[model samples]
Target: MSQQDRIPCFLLAAGRGERMRPLTDDLPKPLLKIQNKSLLEWHLGALRKAGIQDVVINHAWLGEKIEHALGNGSQFGLHIQYSPEGTALETAGGIAKALPLLKPEDYFMVINGDVFSPNLPINNILAKVAIFRAASNKPLAHLLMVPNPVQHPEGDFFLEDSQISALNLGAGEKLTFSGIGLYHKDLFKDLAIGVPAKLAPLLIAAMEQNKVSGEKYVGPWHDVGTPQRLQELNAAYE
Candidate 1:
């Protein structure tokens, strides 16, 4: 398949960034800067380099600023569309609602707005998810994992033999979610569109069927959620 035919994607930027507090009280997390550029811009530029042409960004808090800033994505050489959220719909539900904007590919990509990870391997991640989808009758989602970073030392999920298991259950070491993943649309078929939903439950559900795949990334990455972490990230680039 051609690059465009492989799959299209959406950037998950609609969160209110409640944890970041006063910093995000006025600006959305995706609009915050590191090395003089917004997190969204870095991801867009990276996605463009990986040959993705179309992008859909959903936003709520201070969302207009995102539109005003990235306007149509021409600056980054990608076609852009917006799904303005009157109220944030969390992660899975946000993707569910934006289904119409996505192409009829086997799967699509999602990256959390508050993160700054190394250039992602979008094609490889999709390849792995396709392998899962072929073996299971149900939908599949492939998550990228990174070694537990400082802020979330407890970590979030666990991996064994390329399959991911949720941390809420039995004994297993936790690995950070890495804010990067690929999801087949069928994963959200049972969800009500435009409703609030987190990706955790769905991830666990996929884990039960042994349908979720993951890879641990030992590269440059950071969850730039707070002002302190953002400052550290900026300093490293300088």
Candidate 2:
């Protein structure tokens, strides 16, 4: 991608992490480590490798720690910006808050700060961006789905013919959202700036209009939500 077309990325890190308790009480979840590397750093390394230079990280609880840890992102080979929501806005709201900082691109990548997916493919994401850029009818959102882990066996959405649809009365093999996605800015444009909002409703609304698409990603992905899950991931990844 040319410098003129280099798409920016938004890192979703503003969650209060209620599930991850005391560990998050002192540190924002995104700053937590897996195999000695902070989650945000792992993501930064991959994003930089993917040739995405600009990243906006939104944080609420102990937000300053994230800024202190990563600084201006010079060490990560990228320019960084922070969206410090004083109180954690839910997913969509956080992205909406950072939209301006994401540059003027119509599309930007969004990744969940807490998920551990070190092997997410960079080239695949770039290819999808290319496809979206050239499509006559670009999807409002495209997600990378994963086979449901034991903890979330029922899963989130069903993937059929490269389109993502909500479970139809609980039928079909459901896949877990990898929490990594490419989204058209229009998807979140209507969300109120400061109100807390979840992303599911927005994506579901888009899916109802055949505006969302996705692919299954079979990779090492973990949603490190609980202390046990975190411990298991540390031992397993170690």
Best by TM-score: 2
Q: Per-residue lDDT for 1-238 in model 2, tens only?
A: 5764677888888888889998988988988888999999999999998888899999898888999999999999999999999887889999898998987467788999999898878668767877887888889999999999998898999988788899653444589999999889999889889888999999999999888989888978999889898898889987
- TM value for model 1: 0.90
Model 2 residue 72 lDDT score: 95
Off by over 4 Å in 1: 1-4, 127-139, 167-173
Cα lDDT of model 1 by residue, 72-136, tens digit: 98989998999888988988888888888876466788888888975667667666655655574
RMSD of each: 2.3, 1.7
Cα error of candidate 2 at position 84, Å:
0.7
